[model samples]
Target: MEIKIDDLQGSGIIRLLEEHLADMHATSPAESVHALDVKALQHPSITFWSAAEGNSVLGCVALKSLSCDHGEIKSMRTSGAARNRGVATKLLNHLIADAKSRGFKQLSLETGTQAFFSAAHGLYAKHGFVDCEPFGDYQPDPNSKFMTLVLEQ
Candidate 1:
């Protein structure tokens, strides 16, 4: 699969992001559902990416600049049809690589504390991310688990 920057306009990506937000709301309280919709991901401070093969959009991820040397991972989701095919991992690796290339000193993310997020927690841990205090605009929330990977920049 190819991973590249996306403009968040394709039909496939729009549908996938909608599904992502729907699941987020279903799994967490409204106030805690931080998943971005298509419009939100298009912000100038955020860079969005799509992983696809030919005409099929397999997954997508975004990085939001929280500071000159820090970025927050946002809106990471794999298409329902593409789960377990390593889509999330590829997108994450791409995001991490981009962060390093941009001279970011750290990459952080906020995910749910629910059982539905167990796999995500494992994925981040496997990639050397450790639990951390909330960063950026986030505050302590019982439903949120924050993780960070400090890049050797």
Candidate 2:
């Protein structure tokens, strides 16, 4: 699959992101859903990417610049058809490498505490991320689990 920066205008990717937002809301309280919508993902601080294999969007991920040396992983989703095919893994590895290249000292993310997010917890753990206290503008919440990876340059 070819992984590259996306313009976020294509139907396949738009649909994928919509589905991602839907799932996030369904699994978490409305006030707790931090997943960005299409417009939010298009903000200047965020860089969005989509993985595609010949027009089929395999997955997508985004990196939001939280500061000069820190970033937050956002919108990590693998298409249903691409699940278990290493799509999420590839997207995450790509995002991490991009963060490293950009001289980011750390990368962080927030996922739900529900069982629906267990796979995401495992994936982040496998990449050396560890549990962390709320960072940025986040506050303590029982429904949210935060993780961070300190990029070793």
lDDT score, candidate 1: 0.93
Clashes of each: 0, 0
Model 1 misplaced stretches (Cα beyond 4 Å): none
Question: Which residue segments of model 2 deviate by more than 4 Å?
Answer: none
Candidate 2: tens digits of C-alpha lDDT, residues 33-145: 99998999999999999999998999999999999999999999999999999999999999999999999999999999999999999999999999999999999899999
**Candidate 1, TM-score vs. the true structure?**
0.97
- Residue 142 miss distance in model 2 (angstroms): 0.9
Winning candidate number (lDDT): 2
For each candidate in the order shown, give its overall lDDT on alpha carbons. 0.93, 0.96
Candidate 1 lDDT over 11-112, as tens digits, reads 999998988899999999999888988878889999999999998999999999999999999998898799999999999999999999999999999999
Winning candidate number (TM-score):
2
| Model 1, position 48: C-alpha lDDT score | 96
lDDT for residue 27 in candidate 1, whole number 0-100: 96
